[model samples]
Target: MRFATYRHDGSTRAGVVDGDVVHALPAGTTVLDLVRAGLPAAVEAGTAALAEPEVPLADVTLLPPLQAPTVRDFVAFEEHVEGVRKAIDGVAGVPPEWYQAPTFYFTNPYALVGAHDDVAVPPNSQRFDFELEVAVVVGRDGASLSPEQAREHVFGYTVLNDWSARDLQAREMRVSLGPAKGKDSATTLGPWLVTADELEPYRDDEGFLALDMRVSVNGTEVGQDLLSNMGWPFEELISYASRGTEVRAGDVLGSGTSGNGGCLAELWGTRGEAAPPPLQPGDVVEMTVEGIGTIRNRVVAGVDLPPVAPARARPRTRKRPAAS
Candidate 1:
């Protein structure tokens, strides 16, 4: 069953797609809430009429599939990693240790935009690019899980656009030791969340989700890749992420960029360097991951960004851990 977090008549709700109709839920109106509620048949018991596809699909704003207690985006695609290392620094291939370990970075939860939402180009950023990726949403909670035990933690899957501002990102990382502003702004997710049962067949088929990915901006095809190219599979990332810290059911894990040089930093070189037509103010970016759906948004001026707030620090838990 295809499920979506959508809005109807100004009220946001969880919905299921039945043919061309969008069946909107009443009270427990969200993807996270639906998972928490065990997808009871009782809740899907209403709908006097099926909503028109075009009206609801574009009208109902999308939300990140999971409320996500935490979001750790991992860079496991070798081509992407290699391109990133070599692009500015001229270094090819990741360190052996990088392959041995799963690297990830935390991102702001509030900077999320649903499918069809307008994407703002940050001011002074000439390198505005998109990464087409598949993300895994955690279901059951646990820590120190074995690889064999990792599958149970996954709730579902969705697409992720790790939108990047290359200039600010590159500057901060040199001092901060990793990606900061290069990735801090808005992350786009969804068309809808596809359940684990529906996605299981794709795992380990060559690698990761075996779907073809194609992206276009303002009618121009720029990026395309296969989901099977991931360096680390979802199960491995899940097990590794839960090694010590608890990973909750609603938390989301992103499989960074889908291909080699998929984003501008890797594709067209950075600003002042004259890249191939950087995303102008009025271009429309559209991405589609097979079996999921497509998300299209117009690029607006960075001045349109909603107000920025002070960053929140993740504080240590009040209680310390016990000896294992």
Candidate 2:
């Protein structure tokens, strides 16, 4: 069953989405609550008593599937990584360490927005871009989980658009550490959550879901790829994330940008820098994963704050020996 947290009758509540109609689950239920209970069981309990009325989806305002407890985004697609490397560094290859394990980064969970919401371009970002991907929501708590065990912990899937500020990211990545302000501005997830059981048919022989991922800006298509192209699957990502740490219910794991041209940075690097300019105010970004639905966000305006200066000392420059 598909589920969502949406605004209805002046209050936010959790509901099941069916045929463009939302059936209220319970008066105070939130998608996070259902995830905490484990999705299948929550569905059984929430629908046991069907007294609440159903509402048309068009009448309600949708929210992110849940207020995630924590968000971890991973780079599971090799083609995307190689393409991005080629674009940024002008050489194409995935790092050797990437093959050894799935690597991920913790991002701000509080920055999430839902489908149809307006995303604010962070201050000082001249190269804002969108990433087309899928996200998995955790259903159970576990530490040091094996890939097989990790598979059981996933409650559902949803489309994720990991908005980015490429100019900021490039500067920060050069310091060895990764994206900070560049990624903290916004992450879009929603339309609704499709429970794992609902996608049984799409699972490929290798266990990766064969979902078609697509992204478009304004009215033009920008990126498209199949989830099966990912070198590592969600189970591997979750298992790796659980190593030496705890993954709890409501935690979100994202499949980092799919497609060879997922974001503007990669596109600009591959094509001429003059083409596919960075996102501007009022640009509409729509990302969709087959079975999960689309998340359409409009770039509304930018934050007025200026970029913060580094407080630490700069690297010392070496002097040539007596100007040889």
Candidate 3:
């Protein structure tokens, strides 16, 4: 089943989506709340419509599938990691530890935008880019779960665009910590969340979903990939993340960038940094995953903020002897 959070009559509500119709649930309720309330019961009750009226999908503005409590994005694609490392620092191989376990980073959940929303490019970013990924929403609470255990905890999936400011990212990554301002500006989610059961038919031999993912800039197709290219499946990513930590409902985990040139940075590296210009202001970015639907957004110029000046060195002076 499909679910979405949408605005109707100047207020937002959660509802079940079927084709072009959206059957509204109770007022003041949200999809995130439903996930936190437990998936099976929520699915049963929510699909029943809570005895509320239905609204046409066209009449309501879609929001992110839900407001995530926290977001953990993982790098699960080998080619993407290698390509990005080579693209930025001329590195040739993936890190040794990357092969030992799935790695991830936490991001700003407050900076999320929904489908069709405007994405403002971060200030002073000359290399604004987009990452095509799939995000899984946690449906149950668990700690230190094995991959087998984590599989049952996934509620559904959605398309995620981990918008990036490559220039800022490079500067911070040089410190060996991780990205900050470079990634905090915005991350896009949704069109709608498709439940796990809805995708059962697409599962591959190893249980990984084989969805076709394609990205387009303005009217031109930039890249295409398959979710099956992930080196570590979503189950393993979640299990690693939940090791000795709690993963609760409404938390989101991203599948990172797919291998087949899922981002402009990877493409630039593949093509030797030529052609297919980086995203400029007012460029429309559209991403679609075969089973999950599409999310389209326009890049907009960001609002100006006070400039940060470079640190100045102070002159050294001899310290005066302490008074006795």
The best candidate in terms of lDDT: 3
Q: Each prediction's Cα lDDT score?
A: 0.72, 0.85, 0.88
* Model 3: residue 52 alpha-carbon error in angstroms: 4.0
Off by over 4 Å in 3: 312-324
In model 2, what is the error at residue 11, expressed in angstroms? Answer: 0.8
Clashing pairs in 2: none
Tens-digit lDDT track for model 2 on 208-230?
A: 99998888889898888899888
Q: Against the hidden reference, what TM-scores do the models get?
A: 0.83, 0.92, 0.94
Q: Name the TM-score of candidate 2.
A: 0.92
Off-target runs (Cα >4 Å) in candidate 1 are 37-59, 88-90, 204-207, 269-274, 304-324
Is 2 or 3 the stronger prediction by lDDT?
3
Poorly placed runs, candidate 2 (over 4 Å): 49-51, 88-91, 272-274, 310-324
* Candidate 3, 1-324: lDDT as tens digits: 888998889888889887788898777778988888877877896768835677888788888989999999999998898778766666767889888988889999999898889999898888999999999999999999999999999999999999999888888888887888889999999999888888878889987899999999987888898898898888998899899888999899999988776888887776677357778888999999999999999999998877778879967768976899
lDDT of 1 by residue, 51-114 (tens): 4233446455666555666788998787777666655454566779888878888887778788
